[model samples]
Target chain A: MNAQFRRRIASAALIIGFFVAWELLCLAFNVKDIVLPRPSQIIVTLIERIPAIWPHAVQTLYTTLVGFALGIAFGVLIGVVIGSSRLAYDVAYPLLVGFSSIPKVAVVPIFVLWFGAGTVPAVLTAMILCIFPIVVNVATGLATTEPELEDVMRALKASKLDILLNVGLPRTMPYFFASLKVAVTQAFVGTVIAETVASNRGIGNLMMIASSSFDVPLVFAGLLILAALGVALYVIFSFIEMRVTGWARRKDEFALG
Target chain B: MLAPPSAPPHAETYVALERVTHTYGRDDRQVKALDETNLKIDKGDFIALVGPSGCGKSTILKLVTGLLTASSGYVFVAGREVGAEPVRVGIAFQNPTLLPWLTLRDNVMLPLKIVPPFRQEYHAKRRTEFRDRVDALLDQVGLGGFGSKYPWQLSGGMMQRASLCRALVHEPQLLMLDEPFGALDQFTREELWAIMQELWIAHRPTVLLVTHDLKEAAYLANRICVMQARPGRIIDDTIVLFPRPRTIAISFDPRFVALTQRLRELIVVASPPKDSNP
Candidate 1:
């Protein structure tokens, strides 16, 4: 097999080996179910309870996706405004920095108060958590375009609008993709935080209920499911990123490899 | 210096700067970049401007191209005063500056997409024709089958060669080069110079080149114009008497050696010293 295939196999082996070691250690020590659950116990709980867990998992995914989509739309619009001109950058950037510095978790309570503690608050929280990165990344991409490149474009009688269309927008793709990865994870956190604080459904609420009822294995199972969801979504976006910004990656492949 | 003959009969100037002065900054911080600089280049004349760093040689290029307006005096290109409208001018710098996201062919075709008569019908009837033209230009520049490749896949020399084709693909009447081959090794630089000469001889575009290398300026330019440091102005304009189709062996000619050395001394004297007399 090639190096890439070998790498995939190695990672799979490492993961399986870690879980097997954990199961063996728990069996050897006869750990209590309530005190320390084994990997086998968590897996058993996950498989048996997946039907019950599916709805809550869907709820969390829905909230996160809606919030993330809105965040990206508004984020790119506002980012282009901030990035296009020196005056706009000066006026809007400091305000964005000040606004983004407010902890997104702290905003969850405010959103709950306004939207009455359902999916609305969860989505708003996720949006608040995720939008900052998109705005920051997009603005930075436009702002950092090389002046000499602009010189080359301008010499050909290309208007500012033409240059932005031809050069600035395409240049922002790699930066936009990078922020999407960071923001997707943050969106999950925001949804969970909102759900745990007030909602009656979703993974965060299910885990909360399990923990309160002293069902430690079920709670661990919920955690594992949420993690898998996050990883799956991250991998999807990473694959898309490679396809969309293949040129950007080619320049870095040699240096990084 | 002996008295020079009057203006090139009937003032046959394709590009001219009449007592042009340029200053940067505002109020007390204002600094003089070019002071009463005057130059006139005939149609299809290849002129090399050599000077010390910060001597405003580039300022002249910007002025003629209308990228920067002069503080005082007139700037004319192709018998008209340059203003907001961009005249037919192409430029290449030291760095290749090719867009990384584009294929070499697409990068070369940028002007056709955004510029005037071509921009309006860029996709209409001539799309295939324009694509073929860029492919031919790339092939001419020794990048024959590499038009499909991204810029980063090429070597530094190859990238610079692509840059030259990109600059000229639009069929500009005036070509401005700002140390276009300054970053390459000796062999590559000389090879590019030969390629540049071939292109120039083919079309006879009005060319203005800014360089720090005296020999490069002497070798490629029809007339060499030396400038003084800061508050820059031309100090010497000498015609090269060598015949066309110049080969690499011509560097050994007595006259070529004399011209390079003479221009070198003029630039050395023009270089700004920390303790020069005010």
Candidate 2:
């Protein structure tokens, strides 16, 4: 426990040092606030714009969460189906790859036209951007199950569903969680981009308004909030991943032990 | 020294392979894995297959376990054809192959969770009883306190022991081993051989082991079937007269040495000469 405390303190010090260096660099250069606002100035703007920024933050969060959930649901469902069936994989793989290759941001206007402004377009855009990683990761996990283990299941007369439930699903959970970590962050970015183009609400819109008004410090504050939110969401998902893969954690502990 | 026991009366054949042949690939690029092989294993018999690489020894084991069907021939388990019927056959490989995401207890219970009669009652009332059974098997294999651990946490030997417990947890009638101890160091391998011998004596499951080690074959098997190289055919079917319960000390015995030498000679004779080496 003492060692862990020391490590935490060390990490906090490192983070503080990084921010201090950034502030010092800006001060030493005597850079303009519009180019790179000092940490102190950014904090002041954050405090002043709290009322304006909070609602937009909430809007972005809503769209991001909804899009992320939908992406995971559809991605895992399609991934499992395609992964489990060779025929499905053959049919769907090229199409998924082709769709994924198209620039997601370029389709934002089309999504805006379809869903109109506000949360729906933003959420749909986020979903389109986030689903691919989950599908690819989950599909690979399900498909690469050990042949020897499969034989064991067959020898035991396990049905296809039994194999999927008992072996396939549990095995794929780690991969799914890993992809979720990536997808959630992508969802945040996607929501922000969608809002920048189409929505009147959200942090992206707030940043855009600040930029046009030349409120550089407020723009920096909005960017900081988005970064903080992304990191927080990522940390939350990582915690959930650790819980879901408890068996793997125990195994790792044993190996280290 | 104790005298060897006589063979039990009224031994019944448990597995019979009649003129089994397996050919891989198609007409122009074909390779015969097993060539018209015929063998019978009586109940409680411990048989080992030894040969050079690509000798179809592992192929035979796969065929008996119904993992791979013979191209032309019939495999019978317990006097019934094993084509469509699922027989009670346990298997262990060179790698432990325990699922890394499951606890040792869960891994051992996997077959039970999948296999019927146990699967039906597994979720409700039998949880405690099932756990106890898993505990017993783990105890038998010297892994009593490690049930909550995962595969990656264990050493190679421990993982292999867990795998052995998993294979036998359901009390399978036949155990198929494909070079199960091939990856271990010398001492661990010999130690496992003793453990395996004890397990076989206690359980009396009909075992078919495929190995490249002549000494392993001589130590454990009632019969050692040596196979020739690719498009592999059985070259020798010699019965081991060595007494059991065999120990690592037996490997140093003069008779064991002579038997190993003979098997080595057969393998040397059976192998095709290399053109580029000399």
- Candidate 2 lDDT, tens digit per residue, B1-278? 53443236468988999999999899899988888888888888888998878889888888888778899988898899874555677888998889888788989988788766677878873469999999988998789999988787789999998888888877888899888999999988888898898888888899999998999998988888988876688888987877788888888988889989999989887775672135
Candidate 1 global CA lDDT score? 0.86
TM-score, candidate number 2: 0.90
After superposition, candidate 1 runs with Cα above 4 Å error: A1-10, A28-30, A251-257, B1-12, B25-30, B125-127, B275-278
Chain B TM-score, model 2, reads 0.94
lDDT digits (tens) for residues A38-91 of candidate 2: 999999989987998999999999999999999999999989998897688888
lDDT of 1 by residue, B156-201 (tens): 9999999999888888888999999999999999888888988898
Who wins the TM-score comparison? 1
Chain A TM-scores in order:
0.91, 0.92
Kept native contacts, as fractions per model, are 0.69, 0.61
With candidate 2 superimposed using the best TM-score fit, by how many Å does residue A120's alpha carbon deviate from the native?
1.2
The positional error of residue A223 in candidate 2, measured at the CA in angstroms, is 1.2
